[model samples]
Target: MSLQVTTIMLAVDDMDRSKQFYKELGASLGQDFPQFASFELAGGSALGIYPLAHAAADAGVPADGSGFRGVSFHHIVDGPEAVDKTIATAVAAGATIVRAAESAGWGGYFGYIADPDGHLWKIAAA
Candidate 1:
């Protein structure tokens, strides 16, 4: 059988803040609840927002994770211009600009942004 990751869920401390952040980035909200939310993303995938405490309980793990989680969400765009625009928009939407947009050594352009919960997103075009 084949597998697919249709939805990516991010555990956040503040639901309102996180929801607004994603909304500003053009994510259409869906299945929004007090402790959970879902956003429609490109390519038929979806982005899920959940409370950190609830997530930890669901996973049976501690909610004390800190520092780089050794994972990043990579967003592919049509071109460099799109990359820059997305990063800029994310920053303006309460996301911290982790890295400025620049040319990549692999003949591409990209940048990085961190959400309120420190979720890293790599905006790139290849």
Candidate 2:
């Protein structure tokens, strides 16, 4: 069976805060609920935000874990400048820059940032 990732759900401590962060990153709000929210993304994919406790319960896991989760989301832009611009925008929206945009060994520019909930995102050039 061929599998495609259509949505990525993040467990957030505050729904409103998470929503606002993603909105600032240019994601259009989709379904919004007290415990869950979704954003419409390019290519028909989606980003979902859900309460930390509820998300953990749904997955039958504990919600108190911290530190790196060993996974990250990637945002690809058109060029190196776009990479820097995107990182700046995210920082202005309260995201902490883990790494400033710079030339990657792979021949592209990239950077990393962590959302309010410490979810890492890698912004890179296409």
Candidate 3:
């Protein structure tokens, strides 16, 4: 069977704020509920957000973990200019600049930004 990941769900501290953050980023909203929200992304994939407690319960785990969750999201852009532009937009849309946009040693441009709930997103261009 072919394997593919279609969505990445974030366990956020506040549902309203997380929904607002992604909404401001122009994510097409979908499947909104009191405890869950989803965004229809480009292509066929999607993004989901829910309260941390709700997510923990769904996963049968505790909601007390902190620090890095050891996962990140990536967004590809057209070029270095687009990378810079996207990062800027993310900051304006309530993301913290984790890494300023710059040329990579691998000869590409990229940057890192964290959402309001500290979900890291790596914006890059090949």
Cα lDDT listed for each candidate: 0.92, 0.93, 0.92
| TM-score per candidate, chains pooled | 0.95, 0.95, 0.95
TM-score result, candidate 2: 0.95
> For model 2, how big is the CA root-mean-square deviation?
1.0
- Per-residue CA lDDT of model 1 for 9-110, tens digit only, reads 999989999999999988999999998999998689999988999999899999999999999999899999999889888988899989998999999999
**Clash pairs, model 2 backbone:** none
Expressed as tens digits, the lDDT of each residue in 53-120 for candidate 2 is: 99999999998998889999999999998888989999999899998888988899999999989999
C-alpha lDDT of residue 102 in model 1: 91
Q: Candidate 2: misplaced stretches above 4 Å?
A: none
TM-score of 3: 0.95
Worst 10 residues of 3 by lDDT: 17-26
**Model 3, span 1-126: residue lDDT tens:** 999989988899988888888988889999999999999988889999989999999999999999888998899999999998898888988899999989999999999999999999999999
What clash pairs does model 3 have?
none
Give the poorly placed runs of model 1, Cα more than 4 Å off. Answer: none
